[model samples]
Each structure stands twice: as C-alpha cells, then as structure tokens.
Target chain A: MAYLILKDLLLQRNMMLLAFAYVLLFAFAFQSMGDEGQLVAIISMVGYMFVMVGGAWEEKNNSDTLWNSMPAPKWKIVGAKYLAIPVYVAFVTLVYAVVSSAISLLQIPITTAPINVFVAALGTIGVFVAASLYYPVYFAFGYTKSRYWHFILIFGIVALSSMLPNLFPEKPAWIDPLFEKLPKLTGDAMFLVVAICFVALLVAVSFLLSLRFYGRREF
Target chain B: MESILELRNVVKNFTGFKINGISFSLEPGYIMGFIGANGSGKTTTIKLIMNLLHLEMGEIKVFGLDSRQHEQQIKQRIGFVYDDNHFYEELTITQMTKVLAPFYKKWDWNTYNRYIHRFGLPSNKKIKTFSRGMKMKYALAVALSHKAELLIMDEPTSGLDPIVRSEILDILSEVILDERCSVLFSSHITSDLDRIADYVTLIHNGTILFSTSKEELFEKYSLVKGERSLLGENLRPYLVGYRESQFGFEGLVTDKAAVQAMLNGNALLERPTLEDIMLYCTRGRAV
Candidate 1:
C-alpha cells in the first residue's frame, strides 16, 4: 500500500512546481473569500489536482494491466488512492505555509491565509469528503469513464460556492432553526470530534464501495 | 507432475470476438509457445490467465490453485511481461522498481541490479527515453528479479530486432535451466519459437488448433514440393494446404509417409517449420 502511494507521488513530482503556481493564483483569485476561504480553496484545488492527475497518469500509462497482473490486491490499489488524499492535503498546506511566510517576509501586497490547525483540519476533511465522492466512481469505471462525474463535482462545488449567496438573497426560514441550536449542540472541540467521526464514517463507507466497484472492473 | 499453468475450458466473450472454451496446460520446466495471428485472442487468453479480464465461464489454475481464489498467492510466484511497457514512463527504472519491488514476496535487488547491469540499461534515464528494445529488457529484468517460478510473456519479442530477440530468448533459456521454472510465451514470430519452444499450442480464431510437443508437430507435417501434374485427386487428402505455380506445386501434408508413397519418389518431402505449420493450418488454402 505504501508502495502504491509512493508511485502516485513520484508520478506527481513535477506537479509540486505547478502547485506553487496554483497557491499564488488562488491566493489572489479568492482574495474576496478572505484568508480562511483562500486557504480552503488552495488546499481543495491543489489536493484534488493531485488526485485527478494520479488517475490521469494511470489511464495514460494503461497501468491497470500492470497492477492487476501483479500480486497487489484490488483493495490495496483502491485504498491507496483514498489514503493519499491526506498526504496531498498536507503537501498543499505546506506549500501554502511557505508561500504565506514568503509574503510576510517580502512584504508582498497579496493577502493569503495564515495556516492554523483548525482550518487545516477543516481543509483536510473537506478534501477527504470530495475524494470519498469521487473514488467509487473512479474505481468502478476507471479514469476515462468516470471523468464526466469529476467535472460535475468540480463544477457543482464551484457553482455552489460562488453563486449560492446571490441565488438566495435571504436565508430560508428552515435554516434558522438549525443555526439557532448549533451553539448549544456543539462547542469547537465537540464539533471537531463530530466532524472527525462523520468523515471517518463517510470514508469507511466510501472505501467499501470502491473496493466492490474495483473488484468488478476488468482491465 | 503438476502443470505449471492450466486453463480448463476458459471462455470470455465480447461483442465480436470470443475465446470459445479454450483449454491447454504447460508442464513445469518447459517453454510453451502460444502462436496465433493478430486478433486471434492471444492477448485475451493471456489476460484471462492474469485475471485482467474476468472469465465468463470456466477455470484458470496457476500452480494447481484457482487463479481467482488464490490470485495473490499465485501471482507472487508469477512474473509477467506484456507487449507494451506498462510502467510509468515518466520515471526512471530505478524509481519504477522502487514502486514495484515491494509487491513480491521474494524480490531480490541484487538479481535486479545484475540484470540491469547485464542488459546495459541506464538507471537514471526515464523509461520514455529508452528505445523499444531497452524498454523490453528493463521489463524482462524486473520480471526475472522476483525469483518467479512461472513467467507469462505476451508478445515480448514481437517488434524487437533479431539481436535483442535472441538475447531475450537466451535469458529465457537460462531461466528454465533450474527445472523449477516454466514459461508461456505468446508470439506471432514462429522462428523465435522454433529455436526454443518445447511445446507449441497454435490458436486460430480463438480456438486452439493443436497443442503438442515440437518434435511431434514437426514429424506430423511435411512440406512437399513437386510437379503441378503430380497433384492428383488421390493426393488431395494428403495436403493440408497447397499452392500451384507455373513451374511446380508446394503443400503441407500431415502424413509424410503416405504422401511419399503416393508420389513414389516424384515429390520432395521436407520437415515443416513452425511457421509453415501455422500458415497451412490457419490459411487452409494457399494463394
């Protein structure tokens, strides 16, 4: 499993350079999202770029034949992709930190997010949730067939994040009740615990689905 | 002795092409040449053995274990080389092996390095930069490093120059010298098989025509050439496939003795090459 993850990383080594460019690009592009929003955007976009590029490499190399022919099991192959999500998020966060420090040292005009444990955790979980949604489809149909779903997920997130406030000028009446109980129902520490559990459950379910889909897939 | 690999009535179907209940087996310590024309289900059958393609029906057993149920166990001892390079071409051989070497139970870096050195492969260069023969040698080096008992190669020699092809054949010959290893080599290049294949299994149109010892296959068929007038109705049954020309006639005959008797010293009967046998069997009629 570690070897498979390493393979993805080696293939994406050049992407590390591209990631720095993305960090600078997203920092400016989402300047209006504020520091926290820019952090999440950078983490999500860069991390997910790693995920999608990994899949693209597999398709380009037609490497299913290689993996399926070897002793590596389908579960490990599918599991590695999910496991690499956090790694990708961590790498993106690292790049963001370095960029942020450079801006502070150089006194650059661009405003970027300061890396903190809470928002980093939030970004990691957000990327995990997105990967959980993408992997089952990827494992089922492989990279080529699952590409449309990838586009939809990306576009759906972008559209919702950018357009939702304008779409609804006023919060729906039902949303207020859920918001009102939120402070009492959860403190920050408790929210973190609940978020961890929720992400764990979602990932567990997603892993099983991906294993099943990948098992049925023919190279 | 248990067969090294066995396919029992294996069947896989696509819209237009299907492997129609094909069955064959390779005994340990021998090379089985799987010969077929292009689009003749050679790669498909190899894929089925590797479980890259799901079986619609029938069973594949490698090392006397069901291929699907004990896939990991079976594959641990099985090394494979496909026609095309499947390793990440963006990485060097060193990086690629670092990724693959952990999957096998008995991987030996010393042996891998030995082969890499022997094959003259550049350790630092990316695989995409290597020529086709170099890429193949890299694949062969990887396949041999794991102490694999069974090596399944699909068209590994297809496009290689004769020198490289001969070099690969030499390595394969050396691998089976221990009598614990076996090879199932699939190719359209009959001459390569003629030099090394102990057993030949000819598949045509997804069905195996024959699987037998190389010596037996040669003894069973004879390439005969004689006067066009020597081709009489009585001699027709003796010819598998024949062509007539302005000067004389040539054909492949199954019964060398009977053909020789009928011709009564008028025709020449020579031992047929594997290529002649494959062409005659598949073509059924010569142009």
Candidate 2:
C-alpha cells in the first residue's frame, strides 16, 4: 500500500519545481482573501492537482492493465488514491510554509497565513470533500471522461463562492442560531472528535464508492 | 493433472467485435503459441483470462481455480507482458520494481537482478530512455522473477528486432525447462513460435480455428506449390486457401497426400510453417 503511494510520489518528483511555482501562483491569486483563504486555496488546489496528475499518469501509461493483471486487488488500488490525499495535503502545506517563510524573511508584500493545526485541518477537509466528489466519477468513467466533471466542480465552486453573497444579501435567520450554537460546541473537545469522525466517514464512503466503480471498470 | 490454464465457451462482445465461444487450454511444461491476425481477439482473450476484462459468458480456469473468484491467487502465480510498455516511463526500472515487487508473494530480487544483468538492462535509466527491446526485457525480468508458473505474454515480440526477439525466445525456452512452468505466448510473428512453441492455437474472426500440438498441426496441414494450370475442380476441396499468378500457384492443403497424388510429380508438397497455416486458414481464397 505504501509502495503504491510511493509510486505516485516518485512519478511526481520531477514536478516539484512546478508545484512550488503553483504555490507562489495560488498565494498571489488569493492574497486579497487574507491568510486563511490563501492557505486553504493553496492546500486544496495544489493537493487536488496531485490527485489529477496521478490519475493522468495512470491513463497516459495505461497502467490499469499492469496493476489489474498483477496480484494487487481493486480495493488497494482505489484505497491508495484516497490515502495519498493526505500526503499531498502535507506536501502542499510544507511548500506553503517555505514560501510564507521566505516572504516573511525577505519582507515581501505578500499576505501569508501562519501554519496552525486548525487551519491545516480545514485545508485537509477541503481536499477530502473535493476528492470524495471527484474520485467516484474518476473510477466510474476513468480520467479522460471524469476530467470534465473536475472542471465543472472547480467552476461551480468558483461560481458559487462568488454568488453566495448575492444569493443571500443578509445572513439567513437559521444561520444565526447555528452560529450561536457553534461557540458552545467548540468549547468542548467532543466537537473536534465528531468533526474528525465525520470527515473520516465521508472519506470511507467515497472509498467504497470508488472501489465499487473501479471494480466494474475494464482495463 | 489439471491443465495449467483452461477456457470453456468463453465469449466477450464489443460494439463490432466479439470472441465467439473460444476455447483452448495449455498444459504445464510447454509453450502454447496463440496466433491470430490483427483484431482477431488475441489480446481480448488474454485480458479475459487475466480478468482485465469481464467475461460476458463461460468460464476461465487457472490452475484449476476459477479466474474471477480466485483472481489474486491465480495472478500471483501468473506473470504477464503486454505489447506496449505499461510501467511508468518517468521512473527507472529500479523504482518501478520497488513499487510492484511487493504485490507478488514469491518475488525474488536475486532472480530479477540476474535477468536484468543478463538482459543488459540499465538499472538507473528511466524506462522512457530504454529502447523497445530493453523495455520488453525489463517487463520479462519482472514477470520471470516472481516464480510464476504461467507466463501470459501478448505480442511481446511484435515490434522487436530479430536479435532481441531471439533473446526473448531463448529466455522463454530456458524458463520452460523448469517443467512446472507453462507459457501462452501470443504473437503475429509466427516464426518466433515456430522455434519455441510446443503447442499452437490459431484464432480467426474471433473463433478458434484449431488448438493442437505443433507436430499435429504440421501433420494436418501442408504447403503446396505448382503450376496455375494444375488448379482443377477436384482439388478444390483440399485447398484451404490458394492464390494464382501467371508464373505459378501456391496454397495450403489439408490433404497433402491426395493433392500430391493428384498432381503426380507436377506439384511440390512441403511442411507448412505456422504463418502459412494462419494465412491460409484466415485469409486464403478458396479454389
């Protein structure tokens, strides 16, 4: 299993410089959104880029035939993609830190976020959400077909994020009660446990769906 | 003893192509040459056996176990090499092997390194830098190093030069010396099989023409050449397929003795190679 993840990392090794460039790009683009938004954008965009590139490598190499012909099971192949998500997340986080540190040391005018467990957790969750939606399509239809959905998802998020303020000029009445209850919920450590469990459950369900879809796929 | 591999009434369908109830089996300790024209379902059948494609009907058995139900177990013992290089091109063979070696229960690094050294493959070079023959040799090295009992190769020698092809064939011949290993080598290059195959299975139009021993195949079919004037109505039944020209005529004949007797020293009867057999059986024009 680790080998499978390592394979993706090795394949992506040449792109490390490109990945650093992407970090700088995303940092520049999201600078106006302040630290949290910039951090989340860098983590999710760069992390998801890894996932897409990994899938592309499989298609380009036509490697499903290789893996399926061997003793490796479908579940392991599907599971490895999900497992690698966090690794990608960790990598992007590290890159963001280096870039942020360099900006700080050099007194660059770029706005940067501090690395904290909470913000990093949010970024990781963001990646999980995107991957959960994207992978099922990828496994069902392969990379070539699923890539359109990836574009749509990205566009939809951008469109929705921009439209949300317009759609609700004022906060909904229900959000007020929920926001009030959120502080009390956060006061207890149980909320963190529940949130982690929720993300885990989402990932587990996505993994199962991907496994089922990939199981029926023919190389 | 159970056959090393078996397929009974296996059927698969695509939009315009189908493998129509194909059946053949290979025993242990031998090489079975799967010969077919392009798009004749050789690769599809191989994929079916490897469970890379879902079987629309019938059964595939490897080592007496159901292929789908026992896929992992069966695959552990089966090594495969396809025509195209499927390993990651960006990574060196050393890195690629590190990722794949753990999946096979019996993977032997010593055997792998031995084959690599023997094949003269560079360990540190990315696969993209390797020549077609080197890529194929790397694939073969991985396939052989796992202690595989069944080696399923689809067009492994298709695009290689004669020297490299000969090298692969030699390794295949040596691998079969174990007496426990069997090979199903699929190729359009019939000459490779002529030198190494113990059994030959011919497929045409998604159907199995015949699956028999090489000696039996040679005995059953003969290549006949003679004057175009010798072509007659009575001899039409024996000719599988023949072509005529201003100079002479040649064809594959199922009944060599009858054709020889009919021609009466006017025609020459010779043992047909697998290429002749495949060509006549699949593409030859009747009469």
Candidate 3:
C-alpha cells in the first residue's frame, strides 16, 4: 500500500509542485476575502483536484491495468487510492499554513488565523465528503467514462443550490427552522461528533462499493 | 510431471467474440506457444490467467491454486509482459524499476541491472524516448529480475526487427534452461515459437484447434504441393486446406501416409512448418 502511494506521488511530483504554486497564488488573490475559512476551502479544493489528476495520469498511461497485474489484492489497491486523498489534503493544509504565516510576517494585511483547528476540521471534512462521493463513481466507471457523470454531479449541485432559493419565494418550512438553529448547532460538540460519524459512515460505504465495482471490472 | 499452469473449460465473452471452453496445460521447464490469428482471443486468455480480465466461466489454476482465490500469490510467482509497454512513459528506467521492484518479494537488483546493461538500455533515460524493441527488452528485464517461476508473455515480439526478435527468442531460450521455470508465450510470429517452443497450442476463432507436443503437430500435418491437374475430387476429401494457383495446388493434409499413397508420384509431400499449419488451419478450407 505504501509503495502504491509512493508510485502515484513520484509520477505526479511535478503536478504537486504546480498545485502548490497555484495555491500560493490563489491565497494572495483571495486575501481580500479576509476569511481564513474561505482560503482553507480553496486549498481543500486544490487538494481534491490532485485526486482527479492522479486518476487521469493512471488512465493516460494505462497503469491501472499494470497495477491490476501486480501482486496486491484489488481491495488494497482501491484502498490505497482513497488513503492517498487524506495525505494530499494534509500536505496542502501544511503548505497553506506556512504560506499564510509567511505573508503575515511580511506585514501584509492578510486576515490569517494561526492554523485554526475548527477551520482545518471543516476543510478536511469537506474534502473527505467530496472525495467520498467522487471516488466510488470514478472506480465504478473509470476516469474516461465517468467524466460526464462528474460534470453532471457538479452541475446538479450548483443548479439545485441556485434554484432552491427561487423555488420557495417564502422560506421553506424545514429551511427556516434549520437556519434558525444553525448558529447554535455550529458550536455544539454533540453536533460535531455526529457530523464526523456521518462522514465516516459515508466513506466506509463508498469504499465498499468501490471495492465491489473494481473487483469485477475487466481491465 | 507437475503442471505449472492449467486452464480447464475456461470461457469468456465480449460483444461479438467468445473464448469457448478453451483448455490447455503447461508443465515445469517447458515453453508453450499460444498461436492465433488477429482477434483470436490470445490476449484475452492471457489476461484471464493474469486476472487482468474477469473470466465469465470455468477455472484457471496456477501451481494447483485457484487463480481467483490465490490471485496475489499466483501473480507474485508469475511475470507478465504485454505487447505494448504498460509502464509510465514519462519515468526513466531507474524510476520505473524503483516503482515496480517493491511489489515483487524476490526482486533481484543485480539481475535487473545485468539485463539493463546487456540490452544497452540507459538507466536514466525516459521510457518515451526508447524504441519499441528497447521497451520490450526493459519489460523482459523486469520480468526476469523478479525470479518468477512462470513467464506469461503476450505477443512480446509483435513489432520488432528480425534481429531484435531473434535476440528476444534467444533470451527466452536461456530462461527455459532453468528447470524450475516455464513459459506461456503468445505470438502471431510462429517462427519465433518454432525456434523455442516445446508445446504448441493453436487457437482459431476462440476455439482450440490443437494443443500437443510441437513435434507431434509437425508429424500429424504435412504440406503437399502438386500440379493443378493432379488434385482430383477424390484427393480433395483428404486435404484440410488447399489453395490452387496457375501452376499447382498446395494444401495441408492431416493424414500424411494416406495422402502420399493417394497422390503417389504426382506431387511433393513435406513436413509442415508452424507458419504453414497456422495459416492453413485458420485461413484455408477444411475437409
């Protein structure tokens, strides 16, 4: 499993460098947003993008087939891919923390926190949710066949979020109460525990589904 | 004799093609040549054994262990080389080996470096810059370095100059000299197999035409050439596949003694080469 992750990292070493550069550039551009949470969100998105790039490189070189021929169980191979996501997220987070700290030392008016645990937790969970959704679909259909499905997923979320406000001219019955209690729930320890458990459940289910799909796949 | 690899009633289906009850076995220390025409399920069968493709039905056992049940164990013992290079094209030979070597438990660095040196492969050059033959040599080097007991190569010599093809064949011959190892080689180039194969299995249109000792295949089939007029309706029944031209009629006859008696002094009968057998069996008309 370590070797598999190492292989992907070595293959995408240049891409990782470019991604780090992009994150630094984007952090400065979005500095005026004055919210460390938003910057973390951007960094998280970049981290997740590397997962897709890794899959693309595998498909481009047809190394997936080669990996299948290796002496590793199919499940371990799939698990390695999922495991690499968190590593990427951590690396991205660390780079962002360092860059943001450096910018502050230069007396820039960057509104950066000292690596707030809450924001980091939120960003990690957000990336995990996104990866949990994307990987199972990608594993089931592979990179080439899943491109349209990925687009549809992104477009569906955007379209739904945009249309929901207009669909109910007055606030919806469930939305009003949920938004009213959202501030209290945000600070609740119990709510954070439940959220973590829910995300873990999602990831476990996704991993199992991806394993099933990958085992039966032909080449 | 111990069988190293066995496929029993193996079946696979694509949209329009199917591998119908294909079965063959190879024992220790012998090379089996898998010959077939284009799209004749050679690669599919190899993939099935390697577990690269899922088999629809039937059982495949390597070293007496179920292929699916012991897939990782089986793969660890078997080395595979595909027709096209499957390694990362952008990585240098050194980097590629570093990525692959960790997966094999018995990987020998000395052996790998020896092969690299012998093949004249530059360790630091990227694979994209290597020619087709060099890529194949690199693949072979990797396969050999793993101390693999079974080498399953699919069309390893498909697109190479004759000189390089001969080099590959020579390397295969040396690999076979180790009594603990066996080879299952698939190729359209029958001449390569003819030089090194101990057993020959011919597949045509997803069916096993024949699988037997190489010597027996040659003994069973004879190529007969005769004047066009000499081929009569009575002799037509004996020919497996016959072709007629302006000068003469040439064909494959399975019953060599019977055909010689029938044609007596009217034509020439000689031992059939592997290519002759492949061409006639797949393309020529059968009696």
Candidate 4:
C-alpha cells in the first residue's frame, strides 16, 4: 500500500512541480496584496491541486487502468490520500517558516510574528478542511473527466456565495461586545475553537462521503 | 483438476447491443485462444472477467472463486496484458518495473530481469523512446515477473513483426510449463494462436461462435470451393457461411468428412484457418 501511494506520487512528479509553481505564483500575488493573506491562499491552492486533483488528473491521464490492475484494497488507496495532505501541508509549513524567518531577520515589516504565523497555520488547516470536504463531492460527481465544468462549478459557486450576501444583509444584536469589556476571552481564542471544530467536522464528513461514493464505483 | 476460469451465463449489454450469455471455461495448463474480429466483445468479456468492467448479468468465476466478490484476491494471481501500450511514457523500463514490483506480493525481480534480457529490451531507455515491439516486450516482462497463475491477454499480438510475435508466443508457452498456469489469449492473428493455442474460443458479433480444441476447429471445418448447386438447402444448415460469384460458389462447412463423402468430385477441402472461419462467419451475416 505504501509502495502504491509512493509510486502514485512519484510517477506524477511533473504535475506536482507544475502545481508547486502555480502555488508559488499565487502565494506571491497574495503576499503583495497582504503578506498575512498569502499563507491561506498558498495552502488552499496546493491542497486543492496537489491533494484533490492529483488522483483525479492521474485517472484522466489514463493511469487509472494501470492503478486498477493492482491488487491493493480501495481503502488503502483512500488512506494514501489522507496521508498525503499532511505531507503537502508540511512542505508548505517549511516554506512559510523559511520566508517568515528571512523577512524578520532582514528587518522587513512585511513579516508579523505569532499572530501572522498563527493565522497562517490556522488558514492552512481551514483550507485543508475545505478541500477534504469538497474533493469527495468532486469524486462523487466524476470531476476527473468533467474537470472543466467542475472548475466552473467549484470556483463559480465560491464567487457567487460570497457575492450574494449583499442582496440580503442581517442585523447584528446588542451583545456583540469586545473581549476587553468582559476580560474573558480574546478574538484569537474564538478563532482557535472555530478552526479546530471546522477542521474536525470536515474530516469526519469527508470520510463518510468517501465511503458512500466508493460503494457505487466499479473500479 | 478444476478449470482455471468458468463463465456461466455471463451477459453484458452496452445500450441495445448485447454480448449475450457467454459461457465457457478453460482448464489448467492450457492455452485458450479467444479468436475474434474488431468489436467482437473479446475485450469486453476479458474486462468483465478481470472486474475492470461490471457484468450486466452473469457470473464470472476465476480459479473457482466468484470474481465480483473476491476481486482483489482474484487479481493477485492474475497478470493481464492489454492490446494497447499503457505504460508511463516518461519512465525508463527499469524505473517502471521498480515502481510496479512492490505492488505484487509474489513479484520476483530476478525473474523479471531475466525476461528483460531474454527479450533484448534496453535497460535504460525511456518507454516513450522505445519502438512498438520493445514496448510490448516490456509489458510482457512485467506480466511474467509477478507469479501470476492466469494470464488474460487481449490482442497482445495485433501489429508486431512475426519474429517478435513468435518470441512472445514462445515465452507464453514456457510460462505454462512452470505451474500449469492457464492462458486466455485473444487475437485476430490466428497463425500465432494456431501455433500455440491448445484450445480455442471464437467470438463473432458479441456472442461466442464456437469454443473448442484448436485441432478440432482445423480438422472439423474445411473451405469447400465448388458450385452453388452442390450446396443445396439440405446441406445449408451444415454450412457455417458462404460466398457466391459468377464462376462458382465457395463456402465453409463443419463436418468435413460428411461433406467429402457426399460429393466425390474436386470439392476442395482445404485446411480451415482462423481467418477463414472469421471470413466465412462474416459472409453469413447481412452487411
């Protein structure tokens, strides 16, 4: 199983390098806008392309028939994907750390310690959770073959959902107070809890979806 | 001994066309030629047995186990080579084998290398750089390296030189000697099958025409090139298929001895080839 996973990743080194290049470009773009935002974008783009589309692209590239010929269990194949996300995240984390250290050492104001670092890590997790939840939907819908349409559907929905909120705004209540008033918890603490729960919920949901979709697939 | 594979009432449908109720079995230590033309459901039936394609309605048993229920277990013992070249183009032959070897529990690296040398494939060249024959030899090498009990090949010799084809057939024959492994080799090239195939299965237009011994197929059937009146309605049922022209009538009939005994003239009873069967069978059907 490990061999299968390792081979799957290694065989597509070209695609991985391409994905890495794309992520780097996007990260730099985000950095120019706001260095704080770059981490999230870098993590999301890599997770989506590296972890999600990796297998999908391989299948479309006609490696699916070869993979299907192997004797390994389907769950082992799925588990390999689960293992791969952290490996990709770890790679991103190393890059983020190196950039942050270099910027701070150089006395560059662009690098913010602790808060920026924490947000970046959380954002990475948030993106991981997002891809984990959504990739299964892509798989269920056979997105490998229908990638052009799926690309539109995924990004278009994201664009529309964020934009549509202006048409119907909700009023905020009086109890929307700052942490300074209560001396109880900070905004950072609230974000921490939200990120953990969101990520955990996403992982659980993705596993359930995989089991559901996998049952019907002939391969 | 039990048969290596058995398909009982295996029915697969794609839209309106149906590969209807294909039932045949191959015993251990035999080379079974799955003879068919293009789109004759040879590949489809192989896919169904391999669990690459789902059976619409049928039971496929491989080595006495239900194929659907125990797919992974079944796949472990079966080595498959498809009609097309399907290896990663960028990877070298050595690199590709290194990647695939770990997936099989019974993979013997030494044996794989032996076959590689035997086939004379270059060790370091990228698969994309190899010619058609080299690519096929590489595939066969991969197929043979793993300790596979059953080899299911679909048109493995479509467009290779006669020498390369002979090399492949020779290796296949040798593979059978080791463990009595059964081979289901499908091809349009009857000469290869005739030279090596112990048993034969003929499929035409989605359904199997006949599945029997190679000797029986050649020995029983003959190409009778005579006149149309010689083939009367009384003898039409025995005639598998025929073609007519201004000069005379030529047809294929099974039960060659009966035909020869009936008409004593120069009713030529030539040895029927696989292509002859396919051609005669084609003539019977309306175009």
Q: What DockQ do the predictions score, one after another?
A: 0.91, 0.92, 0.75, 0.51
Q: Write candidate 3's Cα lDDT for A25-96 as tens digits.
A: 777676665575566666567777778888888888888778888897878789988888778877777877
Per model, the share of native interface contacts recovered reads 0.96, 0.96, 0.87, 0.58
lDDT of 4 by residue, A1-219 (tens): 566556656665776666545654565566664555667766666655666556564565455566667686667666566667666666655655666566678866553333365665676685567667655665555556446654765688688878777844763453456534654656777777767777878787786677567545654
DockQ ranking, best first = 2, 1, 3, 4
What CA RMSD would candidate 3 show? 2.6
A161, model 3: CA deviation in Å? 3.5
Clashing pairs in 4: none
Residue-wise C-alpha lDDT for candidate 2, range A1-219, written one tens digit per residue: 899999999999866668888988888889887777888878988888989999999999988989999999999999999999999999989988899898899998888888887778778888898999999999999999999999999999999989999999998889888878764664425665667788899898989999999999998
For model 4 chain A, give the 10-residue run with minimal summed lDDT.
A108-117
TM-score of each: 0.97, 0.96, 0.93, 0.87
Predicted complex 1: CAPRI docking category? high
Give per-candidate clash totals: 0, 0, 0, 0
Docking class of 3: medium
- Give the residue spans of candidate 2 off by over 4 A: A173-184, A187-191
Least accurate 10 contiguous residues by lDDT in model 3 chain A = A182-191
Model 4 alpha-carbon miss at residue B191, Å: 2.1
lDDT accuracy of residue B97 in candidate 2: 98
CA deviation > 4 Å runs, candidate 1: A166-168, A176-183
After superposition on all C-alphas, the RMSD of every candidate to the true structure, in Å, is 1.6, 1.8, 2.6, 3.8
Q: What is the lDDT of candidate 4?
A: 0.75
